[model samples]
Target chain A: MEGKIRQILKDHGRLSIDTTKLAVDSDLYQAGMTSHASVNVMLALEGVFDIEFPDRMLKRSVFESISAIQTAISELKTN
Target chain B: MTTEFSSKILYDDLVKFGHIIPVGVPGIFGRGAVFEEILNRFDAAVSRLAASDHATKVHFPPCINRQVLQKSMYIDSFPQLSGTVFSFTGNDAAHRELSSRLKDDKPWGDLQTMTDCCLTPAACYPVYPTFTGTLPPNGALVDVQNWVFRHEPSEEPTRMQAFRVHEYVRLGTTDVVVAWRDLWLQRGLKILLSLGLPVKAELASDPFFGRGGRMLAANQREQKLKFEVVCPVISSEKPTALCSFNYHQDKFGTIFNIKTSTGETADTACLGFGLERIVMALLKTHGMDPDSWPKPVREVLWA
Candidate 1:
């Protein structure tokens, strides 16, 4: 799931850092991902994981890091 | 996009032509004599076009009550773009600390507290809360010239952080408001074209927030709820939205509890013009020199 999330970030996220070097705990916003690009990431994640982000989870902080996003998807799937 | 005009060139020309006086900030600028003249001339042109339609004219400052912003849902949709006012509300000891910090050339803005009002996000925001109960048979029309603020700092001269918007809002049934909005969209194009601007009216949407906002924007475009008069200010390929016409089908009316004479929810629409953008577009299109413009255009503006 972490590897796939990194791949999704590479494909859809507009990060300034290299995808290979970006850790799961690294802040995406600090890596230069914009709010618009974050939306694209969310959409791509939905397509990949088959989980829609609830409106409450569509905030900037939710997509702050790869781990946070993975946790959000995991919690949504469990629920 | 492909364009000969750059921000540096535009900025220099604006200063040379006495159209704008740049402050230390990126997007905050003071209008010079010629720029103010152009704004007044454009306002007069709009007045002439709207002469037959009597709208109760009002003016608002750059600040609005915080409660008004909460009621308008501005915080929900565009919190990133919103600007709130802050002030120093401290005891004498805190003031002395602030003075010491200033003496040390340290940050002092953190000492201030958030005020009761935020910068006016839109010229029409304060108008909605003022309306209550039923409207007259033909409904109501209001003319507003207000200074609005948004935290969008850009290198483009047309995109200012603080500027004025001249708006005419209509409250009536869906058919009436939409028809009026549509009519004014054409009239607005004519008015700009008369000044020799190559204007194009296209369907557009606001910068809504989150995934739900994406759907709302799509729906707005699908229903043709918004239209903007775009002109090539900075780039010829990608023009700027200098003016906009919006048809809000009972959104504002429902929020403000405004109704038609029969007590049904009233539909609302507004035709708004960015006064600074018009000036910028005119300068960009017709060179920096206003005297060298076409004879008809000069007469329309100066007459």
Candidate 2:
């Protein structure tokens, strides 16, 4: 799941750095992921996980890092 | 009023007619005499609308207090577009070093410190912070004109970084504010039509940030909380938004501690006109020569 999430970030996050080198807890925005790119990442995550993020989870913080996104995906799965 | 010029021609005409003076910047420019005349006429038209309405007219500069901006949560949504004011506060040695670097064409801006204020993002933003504790009998209607800034840099002349917005804000009950917004939406369309530009009011959304912003934008449209008077100045296929009508349901009231006469949080609505965009639309619609414009259109603007 982590590797797949990292691959999704690599595909859509538009980060300046290599996502593989960054830790799961690293800040995506600080790594140069723009708001537009973040939206693309969210859409890609939805497609990959086969789950839709609720309106409440659609915030900058939720897409802040791989850990944050994984946490959100876990929550969505639980529900 | 029936000209078939592209955005490029319209942009050149603005420069040729001395309506707009383009500086080196992509989105920042200096307005000339004719542009100022059109701006004043637009202001007069707005004044005529509020003649008997007795709205409190207020004016603000291009910058806002940083606290107000943070309280308004502008940074949360548009952190990329917000331009905080910064000033140089270097010591003597630092200043000498900066001067030396300047001689060598080095980047000296990094020595500047962020100030307590930032450029104003919206015309109505400063108004909310002023309403600390409020609840008049009928609520408040404010007429505000302010120079606003956004960091979107584009070669398109219509999308300006620094521009003026003339707005009328109504803070009251939801019913009254929504009604007022609807009324202005119609009136705005009529006013633009009178100026001889083909315009239409359509449901729209603020450019919110991230994936969440998409949901928020969808919600805003679903709730019919935002609309724009768009014109085909830049692109005929996708018209540009000249004016916007937003119905912020108790967001500002809750943040600013504003209450209605009945002690409920007051809902707020505003209609904003992008003064430059309107002028651009008029020029695009009426051809480069102002005198060659249709008689009735000239009368509506000049008279």
Candidate 3:
């Protein structure tokens, strides 16, 4: 799941830095991922995981870092 | 002193005095002649105040190209507020069906297809597409006025669904853009102050949609990217934003391939004056009759 998330980030994150070197807890927005790019990332994640994010989970903290995204995906998958 | 009840009273008074004509729409209304005169005079006053800047003036239509709107990424942040154009492009048989549905009062929205253009969300949006290249040493400064549409409808007289904005856009290096925005923040306050309205300038954020949008809005506020000059036009507790100052740090430049003379992505800033809202503020402040307004305020606008 982590590897897949990284791949998705690399493909759609539009971050200024390489995802391979980014820490799991690093702030994606601080790394130059724009609000526009973040939406694409969310859509791609939903498509890959086959889980729809509820309105409550659609927040910045949920997508702030790779770890946060992983945790959100996990919660959705279990549900 | 202004409450929800007073707001309704104000709206009714404006309509009674023929300042605003209710066209049977909540947030849409036709302007009376006196209201139009005041609007035009206030618009000219703003232009006069910014005359020293000598910005290039441009007029844009109310709708922009759909592709440009998508590229600007407005839909991602404000899907709820965006308005897209739709039109009927069908054969004779389909037209007859559409006509029948319309005559029968059945839903006919499905018969229309989305057009290549959408209603312009902001007055400055169409300007970015025109700057898809490098700027001069001094960069670019534009003065634009156009009708902007947002989907929100309400009983608040100040919250119009369609309105005009007089906007000034500056595109250049980071320092230049930021400085321009900061300068305008002060100038905007002064412009409203000169009109004798109880105005205040404060940090603000766009009404981004959805749960994700709340985070984006908080981030925006934290960055202090937007500021609004607000006036108590309808409610004192919840003032209306008469003007806004926004600093877009290379967002449009990156999207539109705009560059500075130094080969760096250009930063952009804009200051917009809500024409109708300002007039509304003036009416609320000085009473509805323009001729009876204070001599100094009347001179500031009429002069």
Candidate 4:
């Protein structure tokens, strides 16, 4: 799962950027990310984990950063 | 056999344009395989262009409260085109019996309720009644996507019973209304061009409901208060309108009592894009291969 997330960052060209700068709750929307990229991230994660993201979690806040996405992935796997 | 691509005549025809059918939507209102790919691309384009913080993305419904429109005499503005849904006694029983008759293709049910609260022909009516009694603090700007309905029956996908609308809307001061539409107009074109869709923009007029509607339509054509982004879908002479930027100078504001901070009636302008028409254009423009689309176009939209 971590590897897939890493690949997402790579494909999105956001891999090399330091994640240390992003705040967990800080909106990725305001962080200069495109919604299209966020959708790609969701699709990539869904493909990797083999789970459909629930309609409720499709908000932009769901993919705020590597940590947020990882948290969502864990919750999905557990359920 | 279920083809790997689930290809259909209807689906392929729409695919020639880049439409994706949304899942779980009912037909007679756009539930079909053809819209699948086209919607997907349109979603991608919308996410890219409508991503700005200022654009408040919204989903509007077509069923406007008749009382709300009636107060403003919107009913008087164009009665023929205005659709309302109403409930009448025994209409349902009569309708069921009629459907049984439709075993031979006959009409069913009480259509009286269909007269009371109408499905909005355009996307903005419901918003006026429920949400926008007053404008935003800095004046409201919204991006509303809706499924619109029209009674016009045609075999053409362009004139189907239902279709999706992507609109960037604004309601506020006159300046705000004009600015919001101008910004969306520019953005609308950029997104269309990015998809490699060829289009022409022309001034458009209100789709007035009756014979007088013709004069209104002609007047609109003359004044150019509205601009239509069209492509060669049905034909060059009657190109499908992929997008329309209209300046409804306080028309809705006055009717819905939508007001600016100063308590004066404000105007609204909406930039609406016909999702199906765009896909039609894309089908006409790029052929069936997204992978081979021009690099710049593909880069902006795909990744």
Candidate 5:
């Protein structure tokens, strides 16, 4: 699953995204990801994990890392 | 309009953060390394607790949808104040597009999209859509910041194509919005005066949309969509707007469908701090020496 998310992170060239040595559970903003890049990352997650993001979660806090992205996908699945 | 804060406060903090760039565009006469230094102090001197009940350490860029912007009626309301995000789109004519970039031709694409994801005329537009369609149970407070863009064609050092803005917005009942606005308006005054920045509170209006915008602006003057915290940034009498307290009275909620748990339409207010203007304000008040600011404000910066 992490492998799948990593590929999606790099898939978009419109915004620069890094997929190497990914850290999970940390705030993406502190890690220096711009808000614009976060939106692209959210679009990538929908493809990798087969989950869609509510407009509310299109923030830095939600896409903190591969694990947080995966966890959000999991939470949305149950609902 | 100019600023009131000392330029020194902005220099040592975020400008030193190493990522900010002092890029230039045509007619954007004020943005050079010089203006960047002044704004740096303003951005750095921000206080987390005093600005509002909320603060988000991260900055949210205003990239909202064209549809959302149209629905908000920003195009019709503040046409003079709007900036749309633009990009080249004739992908099949890729070589032609490249030629336009290289030799400067009539690039087919214009307007930064029919509008930006959000036409960020003010700093607080992002939050309204975030909670649209439903209200927070206990009421949610968001401290948001952005490098807000405005279409003022001014060459003054204080007015620029873009500037940093800090806002703490409250979403809830009419009472919550008013209480938060009233409370912060008081705090905003104290902080400016503490820094010895001469400021005044007066009814204000958004630079409305178009031909009809004048009518709206006049009505706004009557009702006051805005209140400016003016201080001497450029000159003593030419006070810069350091902060603004706005009461939208459900105009945004009504448009965005921001409602409470009770399914009642919500009211909203924002407490905004113009970062560059504040730095300018401090520069106007305290001069450019970090050594000269009041012991308290200076200590806060050093701390």
Candidate 6:
């Protein structure tokens, strides 16, 4: 799940640094991912995981870090 | 906080004094002659302050191309606030059905089809498409004034559904755009001060919609990308934003394909003065009668 999240970030995050080198808890927004880029990342994650993020889960913290995104996707998958 | 009763009272007073004519809408109204005169004078004062900038003046209709709006991704962030133009593009039978529904006071919105245009949400929106090519070595500065629309219906007199914005747009490098926005924050505050407004500049964010929008707004604020000059128009506790300064860091440049003379994606910044809101602030601060306004304020506006 972590590897997949990193791959998705690389493909859509538009971050200044390599996603693989960054810590799972690192702030994606601080890594230079803009709000517009974050929207694209959310859409791409939804497509990859084949899951819909409910309105309650659509927040900055859910996509703030690799681990946060992994946890969000895991929760949705289990549900 | 401005209560509903207070909002209504202010609205009623403006109407009673012939400042705004209520057209039976919560946020839509017709400006009276006195209101128009004051609004125009304030707009002129702003223009005078920006005269040294020598921005290229351009005017656009209230509606913008639908495709441009879609590409700008406004709907993704502010779907609730967007207003799309719809028209009755039906055949004779459909038109008759629509007319019958309207005459019968039934729901008729289903008959209208979305057009290729949407109401302009911001005065600077139409200016981006015009700068799609490339900027000169010195970059580009543009002056535009247009009626912008938002879907939020409110009883607050300052929150108009349709209002005018005197906007200045700057497109250039990152440093240039950021500096211009910062400069305008002070300049806008100074202009309001000259009018005797008790205004203050503070970091602000757009009213993005929904849960995702909360994150967007936080990110925008964290980056210090937006600021506003606010004053107590209707509520002393909650001031109204009369002018906004925004720094769009290569967002418009990337979407509009705007390139700098140095061959990099251009950065963009814009400052918009809410003309109607300013006039409302003026009325609230100096009573309804302009003649009774402080002498210095009158001179700055009327002179």
Q: B82-103, model 1: which lDDT tens digit per residue?
A: 9988999999999999999999
10 residues in a row with least lDDT, candidate 4 chain B: B1-10
Over B2-68, each residue of candidate 2 has an lDDT whose tens digit, in order, gives: 4564667767778888888989898899999877887889878877866787989888888889988
| Candidate 1: CAPRI quality band | incorrect
lDDT of 4 by residue, B220-296 (tens): 55445698877665565676788889987766775577888888888878778787667656655665455665787
Error of 3 at B12 (Å): 0.5
**Predicted structure 2: clash tally:** 0
Report the C-alpha lDDT of model 5 over B198-280, residue by residue, as the tens digit: 78787787775533344345544655657888876555656677788888777778778888889988888887888767765
lDDT of each: 0.85, 0.85, 0.89, 0.64, 0.64, 0.89
Candidate 4 iRMSD in angstroms? 19.1
lDDT of 6 by residue, A33-63 (tens): 8787887788888888899888667667789
Tens digit per residue, CA lDDT, model 3, B1-303: 233436787898799889898888888999999999999999998899889999999998999999988988797778989999999999999999999999999999999999999999999999998999999999999999999999889888988899999999999999999988999899889878999998999999999886567666766776788999998877778889999999888899999999999899999999999999999889888887888889989989989
Off by over 4 Å in 5: A1-79, B1-46, B51-59, B91-94, B97-119, B294-297
Per-residue alpha-carbon lDDT of candidate 6 for residues B143-199, written as tens digits (9 for 90 to 100): 999999999898788998999999999999998888888888989999899988999
Candidate 2 per-residue lDDT over residues A1-79, each given as its tens digit = 8999999989998888999998989999789775556777888999999999988776677888999999999999999
TM-score of each: 0.78, 0.79, 0.89, 0.64, 0.64, 0.88
Total backbone clashes of candidate 4, pairs 3 or more residues apart or in separate chains: 24
| Weakest 10 consecutive residues of candidate 6 chain B by summed lDDT | B1-10
TM-score of chain A of 3: 0.96
Fnat by candidate, in order: 0.00, 0.14, 0.14, 0.00, 0.00, 0.19
Residue-level lDDT for B191 in candidate 2:
86
Query: Clash pairs of candidate 6?
Result: none
Q: Model 5: per-residue lDDT, tens digit, A1-79?
A: 7777667665641223366655655455455453334555666677666777764554444566668877878889888
Interface RMSD of each: 7.2, 5.5, 3.4, 19.1, 15.4, 3.2
TM-score-based ranking: 3, 6, 2, 1, 5, 4
